[model samples]
Target: MSIKKLLFMVVAFTLASAAAQAAPLRVGVEGAYPPFSWKEPDGTLKGFDIDVAYEVCKRLQRECVLVEQEWDGMIPALLSRKFDTIIASMSITEERKKKIDFTEKYYDTPPGIVAKKNAGFSQSNMAGKRLGVQRATTHQCTAEKMFPGAELVLYASQEEVFQDLASGRLDAQISDSLQASEGFLKQDMGKGFAFLGDMISDPGCQGVGAGFAVRKKDTLLRDAMSAIIKGMRDDGTYKILNDKYFEIDVYGK
Candidate 1:
């Protein structure tokens, strides 16, 4: 009836509408591996994983909050409720399934090893060489298992592993093949480095590749995310994001 009353009602309605549309969700991503997941200097998390998490939230019509977390403790953090879900490129392993559930893999890629182009590192004579690997990764387990006799050097992040390799502190490094190629080997710091051999695809050791790890109790959310991932793939959103960071289909079989 009154102008003042109408204004108050409009403001209240606007606030309610905004609140209804903004159901916040916190997502954890490993902010180290570039082209996949990494944190900017200003502490913003960005990359394929972040984009996918945001896209999932968009599909769910919710507000997604990105949380930058170190890779090793991402599962523990998830169990502790540090975030609602993990979009880090964590593998969908049975070992992990015991602790957390995962949607079907969002993408599948093999691991690769890198060394100085002239290093002549090979699977045969790697017996005593120092190898760098990120801690708590399938790469660490697979490298240790497959390349026995080489001394394993573990780091918290792939960035650190590459740093050690570039500085000659490590004879070689192993990580996600795409990350090894683009995140390090193709960069200036990786100028002298090159992949040692074929991409390693030990499904048992590497799990079934990368997927979203969710709390075991969150079945509804997990199903929602799985459907979203498939929708993104079928609708070409996955291709657009994949091509933005990689030349190949990271979602491929």
Candidate 2:
């Protein structure tokens, strides 16, 4: 081969290698939140949040590297630089904003109560019943305030909350309304379960809505992601994923 040709090939290969070296966007996710994020029996993650993350990465022209983190440790991991961002359906509460920044809300939904159809718990009163909720979630905060009299049964994961509820160990549970409906109520184990009363909306604990969370210093990345999220909503990409997981529009008014 000619020396000139060899030099040209070397430069092309170097450029290609550099392009390949572009860092992938490391996204934190919780594999236990169903309909939004969950692990299948085969250990593959698939859910609305998962889809949205992949879509956002595609628009950003970067490869996506999903890092599974427990729900309770999500924000701490992000702060510790374990991941660049969290796309795990985390709510954008003022309390959290004190610790990190959030992109514009991607979706909004209210929490709901789930109980056996025969259970007679009032919306305004549940003096001594056991109420299950995942630890460190808006649902926990909301339940504590809304049903101050009820005993809060804290669990590590929403799946565990559902399990206890299904076994009659819990009188009720408070969780994302859509998640309860799709993840538990619609399933076989939840055959006799139904949502009680109206959906609960507490701006204080539940926040305005769910959004992508990033380090406070990553304003540029947050803004870029916010724009991409807006684009997805305007271009119907958000609706496509929303419809895939929920029967109704979860992006609240």
TM-score of every prediction relative to native: 0.90, 0.91
Off by over 4 Å in 1: 1-22
10 residues in a row with least lDDT, candidate 2: 14-23
Q: Write the per-residue lDDT of candidate 2 for residues 30-67, one digit (tens) a residue.
A: 99988899999998899999999999999988899999
Candidate 1 residues 1-253, lDDT tens each? 9999999999999898756757578898888889788878998888999889889989988989888788888989999999989998898887889999998889988898898887876866789999999999988889878988999999999899999899989998889988888899889999978888778777777898788989999998899899999999899999999988988889867
Candidate 1 lDDT score relative to the true structure: 0.88
Clash-forming residue pairs, model 2: none
**How does candidate 1 fare on TM-score?**
0.90
- Cα lDDT for residue 227, candidate 2: 100
